[model samples]
Structures are given as C-alpha cells and as structure tokens.
Target: MPITDEIKKTLTDPTPLYALAGAGDLAYEKLREVPGKVEALAADRQGAQEMATAKLHEAQGLLAGAPAKVTEAVTALPTDLKVLQERAQGFALQQVARAVELAVRAKETYDELAERGKVVVDKARPQADSTQADAAQAVEPSDAAEPVAEPADPAEPIEAELLDEPPAPKKSKPRKSAPGVTE
Candidate 1:
C-alpha cells in the first residue's frame, strides 16, 4: 500500500481506539484502589519516619569517623616513593574493579526489573484485551460507511519481538591489583 493509504487505514482503524479505551478502563480500575492504598501508607508513615531517623543516625556515626580514618591512612603512608606508587596504583585498580562490579550489578538490576515489569504487563494483558473486545462490540456505526475490518485476535499481543527477553550483559574479568595490595 501507498504510505498515505497505510496512514489513513491506521488512523481509521478502531483497534487502537479500543486499545486506548481498554487502557483507560484499566487505569480507572487501578485508581479505584488508590484511596485504600494511600490510607494504609499513611498509617505506616510513623514507622517509616522512625526507620529513616535510625538510618540517619547510623550515617552520621559513620561520617563522624570518616575524617579520623582518612587521617590515619595518610599518617600510615610509607616514606619510600616506590612503595607509595605501588599503593596508589593498587588503589586505582581497586576503584576500577569496584566500578566494573557496580556496572554489572546495575545491568543485572535493570534486567531483573524489566523482567518483572514484563510479567506484570503480561498478567494485565488479558484484562485489557477483554476490555478492548467489549469496547469494540459496544461501538456501532451511526451511518452507512465502509465496513470496518474485524478486530484481530485479542489473544495475540501487539509485538512479539518486543516481548522477547534481552540478551544478558557480558561478564568482565576482575582487575589484578599491584603486589602487596589488598582488594
């Protein structure tokens, strides 16, 4: 088909409209449960505040000791330039290793969350499809016009490729530290 005809067909298609209506219905249904959820969260606010306060104090304690630790490390530095260079190189290597580890962890976390989100959407898909079917049936032509095509199978998801799991990230080798330096 020509681009214009394809665009026109897409614009005229009722499937998207039904899908939108279905999404709206789902949002409305979820919104109905919000008030109860809000009340429950409000009831737990005191406990949350207490927990936050405890964490804040713990952080403050850690911060208070940080300066002393830094001073101690500085004072403990060896007088020899060669030894200092090795330690500095080891520290740099350790930082690089830490960065790699964190990056790996972040990728893993993102993939995990993506999988979880897909599962949630999959669970909601049937309800949305049912709603779309209901909406399509409820709508009727007001005047004689081109007959609308029958709705596609509601059980079939929109994009199969999009639903495919993403490839896992490649694992990197750990950095080797300088001699006599701990990880």
Candidate 2:
C-alpha cells in the first residue's frame, strides 16, 4: 500500500481521529492560557528588578558613608580606651581598698581569737598538770599490784604461719597465640 493512502486511512479511523481532535483542543487551550501566564511572570520579574535596584542603592549609600563613619570611630578610639582604662583603674583601686579593709578586719578578729585561746590555755594549764600527776599516781598502784608479763616475740607466730600455710598463687603471664596478636 502507498504510505500516503495508509496515513489517510489511519487518520480517518474513528478512535485515532477522536484522540487527535482531543489533543489538538488541549494544545489550543494551552496556547490560550500562555499570554496570561507570561504577563504574570513579566510583572513578577519587574517587581524583583525594582527591589534589587532599591537594595543596590541602599548598599551604595552605606558604602559611601562608611569611610567617614570609620574615620570618626577610629579617631575616638584612643580617648574611649583611655576613659575605659580610667574607669577600670578606679574600680581596681576600690577593690584593693575594700580587700585591704577586709584583711585588716580579719587580722583583728584572728588576733582577738588567738588572745582568747591563750587565756583559755593559761586558765587550764594547772588543771591539766594536776590531772597528769593523778594519772601517774594511779598507774603506780597497778605497777606494784601486778607482775608484768614478758613481751611476746612479735615475729614468731608470723614465722610459724609462714612455715605452715600453703604458698600464694602465682600470677601467670599472658601468652600470644599468634605472632600478630595484640593486647
């Protein structure tokens, strides 16, 4: 059959004809929708361009003013630092003075407590001495009343146990089963 005749026959077939017609109608509807879509996109593009241009102007303004502001801040830095240093020094001096005052108060309290301790020790010395003498006297009575036992040989029992008890378990060293083994 000739290709043109076959093509014509296929085009005339009712199922294919209906499908082609539907596709063409869809294409036409899409084409009709394009202008409105393009218009909306262009409007959006214009708004973005305007926002970018405004930001660029703002950036340019900041850049233009930056040098003078930087110079002013730099010129003021030393004086600002000096003022800050003076404040810090004043605070340091106050802290040192407060610390010294606290130390003096602590010293006075410590001295007072030490003096009180000395007085207490002085008051208790005679009593402590008398108690020691009384303990010694009481010990004298026991020394005379009982016969003293001879002191045990401290190492004898330990030596005897050492001779009798079984030896302690020995620690075994780890063995490498293979040459490449690691702990």
Query: What are the runs in model 2 whose C-alpha is more than 4 Å off?
Result: 1-79, 141-183
State every prediction's TM-score relative to the real structure. 0.39, 0.31
Could you give me the TM-score of model 1 versus the true structure?
0.39
Query: What lDDT is reached at residue 120 by model 1?
Result: 57
Candidate 1: list runs displaced more than 4 Å: 1-75, 141-183
- Which model scores highest in TM-score? 1
lDDT by residue for model 1 (8-77), tens: 9989865544445545556777899999999999999999999999999999999999999999999997
Task: Report how far off residue 45 is in candidate 1 (Å).
Answer: 14
For candidate 2, lDDT tens digit of each residue in 1-183?
699999998877554334444455556778999999999988799788999999999999999999999999988776677888999999999999999999999777555555555555567779999999999988777655776544388644555546588998999998758777766
Write out the backbone clash pairs for model 1. none
Clashes of each: 0, 0
